[model samples]
Target: MCDGYATHNGELAIGRNLKVAFMPWKGYNFEDAIILSERVVREDLFTSLHIAEHVVSVRETKRGSEELTADIPNISENATKDLDENGMIRVGAHAKTGDILIGKITPKGESDPTPEEKLLRAILEKAGDVKDASLKQNHLTKVL
Candidate 1:
């Protein structure tokens, strides 16, 4: 049985079928890799990401046609609901390497500060006190 605890930067929704395993990280110890691909893909650590674990076929029901499973650790009976009472994504579904999923918790928009803008602002604001402007610029350039 899977421990159901997967160490991923991404969240695993309630009913999604994911191939969870301990995959190699930097060296000796393995990190819990909750991924879509059952097999290891080349250079998977950095490039090539998946958004969903499986293609959920829609049906007449608002909840869709995907079957919920109990294998996932903390999944509840109502895991297949399109959204919970609070309007968050239903818990059980998850994204994996090859699946075409939908809905992101963090929608893409101009809602937050851009990294470049923030970095540039930080440099300009702080560099005023520094003697060497070129050196600070160099450091920022490297960061960018």
Candidate 2:
């Protein structure tokens, strides 16, 4: 029995397409992305090949009697946090279907302060100019 599985060499953004001469899976020559696009759809590999700064958009293909349009979908990035000045992935970074394209890392001061940090800052401000006073959480007080 023939195995119904194929490995993709590279991944394309869901809405993007790369013109190719031939595709191994289709066993034919075409002017659009072949196996990569199928993998994107079959495997449901949405966004980011392996990391941030990359995404996979579902490709769109339509064939008409006189016209053929194959529009690839746009890649969706997984990272939603604020990026540091130098924390973005470099341009022209090549990644395979299962490789890392962009690695996201928030810098120490780039991301918004956590709720604890904000609360601490507020408490510190409230306690400002008071030498012997410190803020403490009171479990006995119930928020209405």
Candidate 3:
């Protein structure tokens, strides 16, 4: 009967069954309190792995369109070490907090230009109106 019930319910064992002792230690385990061994936590016996997906989208704006590139201005080389040539994170890379996952740039409106910028714009004949829009990691995680 038990076998039939388990088969019908699709139930399976999920944890280890350990031998427990009901003993009082400094009056802490007098009631329904339970104490766990340090080895259980050190070995991560109860830890579970959770997988999540994040996405980045590029769309057209009123000024210009968004672009993805690895050559983002004002960012250090160490911050973009995990990114590939396509501005995306490399597969199986270990990412930590504040790491850039994707390097993006968006166009911005033109304000008052400085003397150097005006000279460069006049020589190059191109207006610099873009700002960094990179995606950064919120927590320490591994990219898979």
Candidate maximizing lDDT: 3
What lDDT would candidate 1 get against the real structure? 0.33
The candidate 1 region of ten consecutive residues with least summed lDDT is: 132-141
Predictions in order: lDDT:
0.33, 0.32, 0.79
1 against 3, candidate with superior lDDT: 3
Candidate order by TM-score, highest to lowest?
3, 2, 1
Decide which is better by lDDT, 2 or 3.
3
Alpha carbon deviation, residue 83, candidate 1 (Å): 1.1
lDDT of 2 by residue, 5-35 (tens): 3423443323444543444445555554534
Q: Tens digits of per-residue lDDT for model 1 on 1-144?
A: 334456334555344344555666766565645455534455353343333233333233221122222222233334323333332334454423322122212112234445775477568852111111010111111110
TM-score for candidate 1, residues paired by index: 0.14
Residue runs of model 3 more than 4 Å from their true location after superposition: 1-47, 111-127
lDDT of 3 at 8: 39
Clashes of 1: 14
